[model samples]
Target: MSLESFGEQLRRAREAKQMSLGEVADATRISLKFLQAIEAGKFSILPQAYIRAFIREYARAVDLDPEKTIQQYDMANQEIRATAEEWVSRSRNAALRQTKERTREIASLPVFSQRSVTIFAVLVVAAVAVVYLLNVGSDSSQQDDVSEIAFDKVIRESEAATVRTESGRALPTFEARDDSLRLEITTIDSVWLAITIDNTRRGEYLFAPQRKRTWVGKEQFQISIGNAGAASFKLNGVELGMLGNRGVVARNVLITRSGVQKTQQ
Candidate 1:
């Protein structure tokens, strides 16, 4: 079976169920473009790590046996392999897409807060007072000394007040508990990750080099990583080294408060 034939089979299965690509995409939360790519036998459109997962979801949506479908896909694509450079390129592209999406989301946020405006106003008033004092002291040496002392006092008082305000607004520290789990991911290169927290909340992220993110879960975390060796994990502050070799795909890695449970590659 060729890759194109495999994709055609999947397409036929979907058509047999009378389901549109858009409907499948909505149901599986897979991108429409990815669904289209799958049907078109364009597996290279996605990271290698995600291809199997996406195929499994697509198969399930079309009422096919996900594992069986995945097996067929693997068999069909045995001759086709992605190089390390290709993986790096795909990861970089995914990171760029994620960055653009995040940029759009951040652009919608409020630019300035009331507290920021208040602080700016206070700084402006302080600057004006300092200038007035300096001009008044320009005529005499004694006045200059007095002005310097006043300036220093003003700066100290302003800093003290700012510190007090900041302390009042500061968020409480987080103290990790026995039951909670904290998973921190740090990326050394562009990588794609899918994470499920407590088997409930799921999210997919594309990270650029030198990025760090943390997630908390009560029970466990299930994660899949593309470019596994390019990223490191810390569970409750205990470092778990790279999941696999460079450009390798790691799937269904389980992590709990105790430590990394199992890593599947």
Candidate 2:
């Protein structure tokens, strides 16, 4: 029955639970910034659906009713959007006024003759041909790199062995055949992983059993496994075996031209 803002209500609820923002973040896996935004009524900082999700998580963390909190958040959002629409209408009116003042003579320019249009089209075609030739030359350079390496054979482990971080453990090796390394993975069980191919963060995603994920890397791959025994991996078509046991966590396993190796933590 309280007529307070959604943020105020949530904030009061959180305070009643006697918890800090960081504690809520740790419990819900929601970032502190998002938590702050939620408590500040900065719903515009996040997508509407995500704001609702944050509200639900925050409510759960504070032992508040998620449905009630989400309802309050939705009402508050509708009000905010309504005000935004009013502002947009006023801005549009001002823009129209300004537009009417600018009666520039853009149509005064001479139109292209039929012969001039033909010449312009020809130039555009020539430019496109130049771009195509440049791309083909770059592709040829990459092809030359593959030809330098021998794919007639692949280097692999003598047996399915666990890759280790210790200095004495042998690392697997594969010949670099192109501008990038091709990595193929198949989930053996329900697994979660974080993948970075050539330093690009592909993000953490869940994979069901038998799901295949293929990635390419120009230099190396950085992979973290939530369940090591849940996935089978291949480097350029060479089977590398399962990573580890069930429920095992592998952080930043490195894959490069030299081979697959667990990074030294």
Q: Best by lDDT, which number?
A: 1
Top candidate on TM-score is 1
Q: Write the per-residue lDDT of candidate 2 for residues 1-265, one digit (tens) a residue.
A: 2213778788888889999988986565455666887777765443333456567768888998888877876676556555555655565455444433332222233875676566556655655565566555445433312221221111112112333323535444434556668888888765656666666434345455567867766788887665677798898888887777765555668888777877421
Q: What is the alpha-carbon lDDT of model 1 when measured against the actual structure?
A: 0.69
Evaluated against the true structure, the overall lDDT of model 2 is: 0.61
Task: Write one digit per residue (lDDT tens) for candidate 1, span 195-230.
Answer: 777766666666656778888778898887767899
Q: How does residue 209 of candidate 1 score in lDDT?
A: 61
Model 2 alpha-carbon miss at residue 195, Å = 13
Model 1, clash count? 0
If scored against the real structure, what TM-score would every candidate get? 0.42, 0.38
- Tell me the lDDT of model 1 at 135: 41
